[model samples]
Target: MKIAFYGSSLLSSYWNGAATYYRGILKQLAARGHEICFYEPDAFDRQQHRDIDPPDWARVVVYDATPEALTKVMDEAADADVVVKASGVGVFDAELLDGVMRRAAPHALRIFWDVDAAATLDEMRADPDHPVRAALPGLDMVLTYGGGDPVVDAYCGMGARRCIPVYNALDPDSHLPVAPDPRFACDLAFLGNRLPDREARVEEYFLKAAALLPDRSFLIGGNGWESKAMPANVRHRGHVYTAEHNAFNCTPLAVLNVARDSMAQIGFSPATRVFEAAGAAACLITDAWEGIEMFLTPDKEVLVARDGQDVADHLSTLTADRARTIGEAARARVLREHSYALRGAQVDAILRDAAAARAADLPEMERA
Candidate 1:
């Protein structure tokens, strides 16, 4: 099958958080013998800070962030077997959604793959005039990065024909254990760009934890956080690229996962970093969110924290051997049940079934 995916940057993880999810899923789809053409905009200096070159698995089209370029790409993608318009393209998102649905072939499966379903749903709910809300009924399926049952229910309630949660998973090859690097060694580390929705939680969960343990080292990575005030113990390494993720995960005694406000409140939406850190066998400390148990066994495979105090307590008492034990256990669990190969197969089956159903619904003469 030829899948044309219009999403955030696939060649860069600069300011784009969805890059990992796109690469993991689309690369796996390509590995399953599907042709994938990823369309991403040249915006936010992502092109200038690319972490990867054009990959062999998928064809990447880096188009300009202009109406003309968008129209051209839309026309170019009309022949794909499946058309996907993902959330948070950072450029022409609504137009891309409208264009995909408008340009897709009658039999092609049109998917609105929401990388940030919780936030997107919040937008739609708050603004009835949101473009995605208007496009819901036309989409063949709504796929999410996470947000389990709640996302599915919300999308269906909002008039989606079908909604599925294609949660994040491990790409073992892309993110596996690596030798610890001194540059990333710390008591606890976090790597996420600063954003309005997530900044407060980062403060509450990460910065406050650093403050609580004054003598411990805490590493902060990702862009747009240089100017943000932080505890004296926190070290800001702006925008660690994907290639260094393994070291970033492996070297830390425990890596913290703090979901944005919406995701924390909505629950069940795990960030892509969760799987990456776990895949690299990092001890993960995630903010308390519902449905985490569905992914990782809390207290054994992961450490769940309700506030800064819990994080501080976990780190204060954590032994090197204990952290290693938890990390290894987490890796073993994800390796057993959450690899991208498994996720890709799941996605392939879903797309194929949807395609088959579409064919079955056609008229006898049209089927030919």
Candidate 2:
């Protein structure tokens, strides 16, 4: 099957969370003999700040997103078996969606892939006049990276024909544990960008824990955090690239996860780092979330922290042997159920089913 995707920067992940998810899922899909054409507008200085290049496996078509270029691709997109319009293109999402819908054949499946389903749904509900709301019913399928149940229900209730949650998955080969560098090795580490809504949780879980362990070293990575104040023992490394993630994960005694406000509110929405850290066999200390146990068995596979005290206690008490055991168990679970290959296979099946359904519904003259 041939699939076309219009999303943020397909080949760039710098300061972009959705790009990482796309790269992992699409790369795995390509490896499984599916053809994918990623249509990304040459905007946002992505070329200057690219973190990951398009792998040899997939075809990436970069367009200017100008009127002429968009018109040229409209016909091509209409011919694809599936065309996906993911949220957060940030450049020409509205224009691209309009053009694709205008030119698409009745049988071409249109998907709205929402990486930030909670935020999008909240925005739409608050203001029905939002541009994307009008496009929802036109989509054949609504897929989300997170917001396990609420997101799907909201979209379906709003008139989407089908809604599915395709959660983030770990790429075992890319994220497995590796030799930790001394510079990166730390007693604890947290990697995520600073967003206003998530700052309080970060303080309660990560900063407070680091403060409690003044003698132990801690590292914080990700962009938008360079100006944030940190404790003396806490090291801030701004924006570690995808390639450096495995090393960072392997080196940490335990990696902390702090979900954004939207994800925390929606529940059951695990970030990419959770799967990546687990895949690298790094002990995970995550903030208490409502549906975390559904994804990772809390006490058995992961350590749940409700506040600074809980985080500090987890760090102070767990023996190195016990920590390693927990990490190994988490890694095993992720490999068994949350690998990108598994996600790719699931998506492949969905696409096949959607295509078959479209074919069956077509009139006799259009069936050819």
Which candidate tops TM-score?
Answer: 1
lDDT of 2 by residue, 109-178 (tens): 8888989888889988998876668888788888899787788899998878999999998888778889
- Clashing residue pairs in all predictions, respectively, total 0, 1
lDDT for 353 in candidate 2 is 88
Residue 361 miss distance in model 2 (angstroms): 0.9
lDDT of 1 at 100: 78
lDDT of 1 by residue, 201-271 (tens): 99999999999999999999998899999999999999899999999999989999999998999888889
Candidate 1 collision pairs: none
> lDDT for model 2, on a 0 to 1 scale?
0.84
| Model 2 bad stretches (over 4 Å) | 65-75
